[model samples]
Target: MEIKAKQLDSVNASAHIKIPSQELKNEVQNLAKKASKTLKIDGFRPGHVPVAVILKRYEKQLQNDAEQNLLKNALNNALKELKKDSKELVGEPYFEKFDKKDEEIDIEFILSFKPDLKLDDYEKYIPQYSEPKATKKEMDEKRKELLKTHASLEPIKGKRALKEGDFAKFDFEGFIDGKSFEGGKANDYVLEIGSKQFIPGFEEGMIGLKIGEEKDLNLSFPKEYPAQHLAGKEVVFKVKLHEIEELKIPELNEELLKKILPNEKEPNAELLEEKIEEQIKNEKLLKLVDEELKAKFADALIENYNFDLPKGIVEQETDMQFRSAWQNFSEEEKKELSQNREKAKEKRDSFKEEAQKSVKLTFIIDGLAKLRKIDINDQELIQAIYFEAYRNGINPKEHFENYKRQGALPAVKMALIEQKLFNDIFFFSKTNKKGEK
Candidate 1:
């Protein structure tokens, strides 16, 4: 066996692997025997078939299968040999080119892998962040929100009039030019006044209506309404109030606090305030650190390296993004999208540079992860998967399989590792700025 590597570019390597004719013949013969057992032929009794007859019947196929297996096995061996005796091997191996012109047979492959980064000052580039402190005002606001969550609603006595936050039932019919329009009529529909749950001015028009009251609601639909014909059209609604009930908000006290904050026995407003402030400060810190780290990481990687990414990967990613966008659009929106395909294509092309950078960053990160021996534990992976599943309202087991089928397992694993790496890096860093004392 002979192997030689040629550099196509920074990210691509072409290798020529030569297998001896004698070796190829031996491999083919051995493979034929392994395949002959279950292979049926018209007068053959399983493994008892003669090799000459078998060769005569299946030599061509056997040789093809042997060649394929040889390519895979030989490629693996060549990569190992190159890594050990020559330069380092990069990403996954691909069979770029091949030839059988000579009886000796030479196979060529183009492998895509990450390039090396000169990061002598990786630690120095990360921005030093000041530790955040929760504020009293912020904590008070959070406490108020908690109090509102515990607030109870009670019906107001006496028939004054339906107002905002009041539940009301009514019979209404809307008409345009004296003819009833679509979606303009309902009988005994219960609604909350000033809820903005209905068309423009519809809820506001219902406000201040006494029991058994009758009133006419006049309004025009917005120009962007979903119903094209009804959009920007004026309609009159004849509203008849049937009954009204006032909303009673509950007070935040001992009983309310107990129910709302089960973790804190004897919880008070001050304790709730502290918890709220702490939550806000933690959220702000995490958000700021995550954004900064991503930007810094990308900048660091890009600063040290520059190369042309494979068009295949970029096209694949773009197509995936395009499908995602399309899936989010409605049927009419899809038609509009189709009509503006050139614009969409232009938008996609504009993202090519970023996509290239992303690919490079991914390759480098993956390489660094391997070099650092970074591995995600089963528990962490499962937790991340479960969190995502819960957010998407899907069963974890089903979602995991779906993610794998969509070829997103690598992405999920990479995301989990990247998050862990950043968290570990930030957890112990000291701050020299802000409220640190």
Candidate 2:
């Protein structure tokens, strides 16, 4: 056997392989013998069939099988010779050409793989941003919101028109084209006036209605409404205001604090306020880290690194992105896309650059993980799966099995590794700054 590798580009290569005819002939003879043991002849016993008869009866089939096996072995050997693994391949290698001449069979294969990345120095390319802090005003607002969660609703004392922020209990029936539609009527429905839970003008029209008052709201559904039949159509809601309720927020005193935190040995107003402030600060910081810092860091990394992406990998990533984005669309939007395939194609095409970037980033991260010896063991993987299951309110065992069936466990592990890498970088920066101080 002889093997030669040629670099087609940064992310592609070609391998020319040749196998001696003598080796193939030997393999073909071995296969013929194996097949002969299963043969049933009228005049000969099984396993006693003559080699000449076997060759005469199944020569083409045996030779084809031998060729297939030889090609597979040769490709594996060629990859090993080039210091590559089949797992590193983006897709199956393309059989560009093959031929047989005299005593040797020659074959060429085109292979796609991840390109080598030259990452820029992280300390210089990644930006620095100040950690977010929660202000007193923000803390106060959060505290109020938290209090409202525990508040009780009480009926209003006097005859007054409803207003925004008031919870109204009402009965209503909606009609389009002077005919009632499905899901157009409800009895004793409780709705917040400003919640926007109902269609436009339905809640707003009830804002000035007094108890026991009935009003007809005439409104038009937005053209982009999910229900195609009702979209852009005018409808009338005959609503009767039955009762109005207002929230009575509790005072943030010792009794309320003790009720909120039953395990506290010595709960006080100061401690409660401190806890609220700390919670708000942590929430804000996390939001800043994910939405701002992470995005900026990723963009900087992309700008600093350069590599050609494997075409097959990029196409797969792009298709995945397109499907994900399409799944998130409203029914109306999906209908529009389905009706116009060109528009859908344009949408998919728009993701090409982003897909390339995403594929490149995965390669860069994998390379860094290798260099840094970042790894996730079985225990860590199980723990991560359990955590994910808990977050999604699913059974851990079921989630694990689902991931395994979809072949997504590796993707999960990669996500965990990337998260760990980012966390390490963040903490390292913080520690280095403190050391400088």
Score each candidate by Cα lDDT: 0.72, 0.82
- lDDT (tens digit, per residue) of candidate 1 on 322-393: 676667768986776578978767756765766777777776666556655677977787788988899977
For candidate 2, write residues 1-437 as lDDT tens digits.
Answer: 88888767777778898989998999999988877788888799988888878889888998899999998887787777667788878766776679988889988887778676655366565556655567888988988998898899999999999999999999999999899999999999999889998888888899899999999999999999878999999999999999999989988887888877778899888887888887886676567657776678778777888877776677778888999898789999899989999998998889999999998788878877676677888899999999989997899999999999998898899999888776556544553222211
TM-score of candidate 1 against the unseen true structure? 0.62
**What's the true lDDT of residue 265 in model 1?**
61
Q: lDDT at 380 for candidate 2?
A: 98
Q: How much does candidate 2 score in TM-score?
A: 0.66
Best by lDDT: 2
User: 387, model 2: CA deviation in Å?
Assistant: 13
